[model samples]
Target: MSQRIVDHPVLGSLAARNQLRFTFNGTPYSAYEGETIAAALLASGVRTLRVHEEKGTPRGIYCNIGHCYECRVNVDGVPTVRACMTLVQDGMQVTAGTVLPTPLKKGGHSQ
Candidate 1:
């Protein structure tokens, strides 16, 4: 079941749009045309888009706009792509960002 707002009080009925396929963390999912990556994931019940770089905390759509970087996810071969600002593309590959281990956590740096 999709969680899209089909009928809004002000926007009325939702217009029919083309459905496209995309992959999130190797899982194939469908998204509507012109919808952002964050929107698609949220509609699919995916809240945690990535984890904190150091603290390992789960991060999801915070601002919804392009201001906050909490919704950053890896797209294709790119890293740190803001999911809220990027539109979902057909066959696009998206992966959740993982927290990088610090020097102290990685055997106190390679020397």
Candidate 2:
């Protein structure tokens, strides 16, 4: 798939192609480096970030910007990250955190 922001409703066409690779919950996914995690998630058709904090309600991207933390997900082993704020990186190991994003502690070390 084309990582460049060729066409988007909010941001319009991206200026250039930004190829990058990363993982989501142990599964590999693709996107451009530097693009906000939220935008990358949306581009990858990954709606439904995680269940609500209290009621466990389903949620997804609303604003591409970082004003809302609704699209927050576990990234680079960090929990409660605003995907829209964090930019993608090469060889990044991202973890989905819609629900309980607590890092999987492996012998007290987060994997």
Candidate 3:
């Protein structure tokens, strides 16, 4: 899928802005200065940002706002960052939720 918004019904043609580089699970992607992490990943055709800590259910951006934590991910060693609320920065390292430590076990045991 193309990782760009060529034209918008209301916004018209999106001009090329200063491009920034970031990696998702070691795969590189380009993003603009003002684009959110969720927007960038979605544009790149990435639907799953993380998984359920205990159930292993796939998770992505549920709410574009910061309220929902479904889009939580690891950014530059920091964990539980909301992708929809976080802005993409140049040279940022993003990892999937699968790599994060599970807060609880199958039997509700703290790990």
Candidate 4:
């Protein structure tokens, strides 16, 4: 099943838009013009955008209005760019942010 809303009673039919190509975590995906990165990922069945930076818990789109950062992802080497707010760009490369590795202490133990 397609995640896209093809038709809406109040908004009328969704106008066809040119397809945009992008990648998430090295995997290719397609998006229509004007769709945000989070929307594109959701349409492609990707529910988990990233894990918590420190907790390692899975995080997806929340609030979706740029207030919550759950949908943040790495884009073209930039970190913490909110996927929910950023529009998809052709040839864009996106990556999920993962928990940072614990710092090692002088005795070789994790700090």
* Residue 71 of model 3, lDDT score: 96
- Please provide, for model 3 over 1-111, each residue's C-alpha lDDT reduced to its tens digit, 9 standing for 90 to 100: 767777678755646567789999999998877889999999999999998876788999998999979999999999999999999999999998884355454654543
Q: Is 1 or 3 the stronger prediction by lDDT?
A: 1
Report the number of clashing residue pairs per model: 0, 4, 0, 0
Q: What is the lDDT of residue 2 in candidate 4?
A: 53
- Indicate which candidate wins on lDDT: 1
Distance (Å) between predicted and true CA of 2, model 4? Answer: 2.6
RMSD of each: 2.3, 7.3, 2.8, 3.1
| lDDT per residue (tens digit) for residues 24-109 in model 4 | 99999988888899999998899999998767899999999999898989999999999999999999999999987654435545
Q: Could you tell me which residue pairs clash in candidate 1?
A: none
Each model's TM-score, in the order given?
A: 0.85, 0.68, 0.83, 0.84
Candidate achieving higher TM-score, 1 or 2 = 1
> On residues 8-97, what C-alpha lDDT tens digit does candidate 2 reach at each position?
798655655667777776777777755766677677777777667645788778786778778767767778887778888878777655
| Model 3: worst 10 consecutive residues (lDDT sum) | 102-111
- Where does model 3 exceed 4 Å of error? 8-13, 99-111
Candidate 4 matches the true fold with a TM-score of: 0.84
| Overall lDDT per candidate, in order of appearance | 0.91, 0.70, 0.87, 0.89
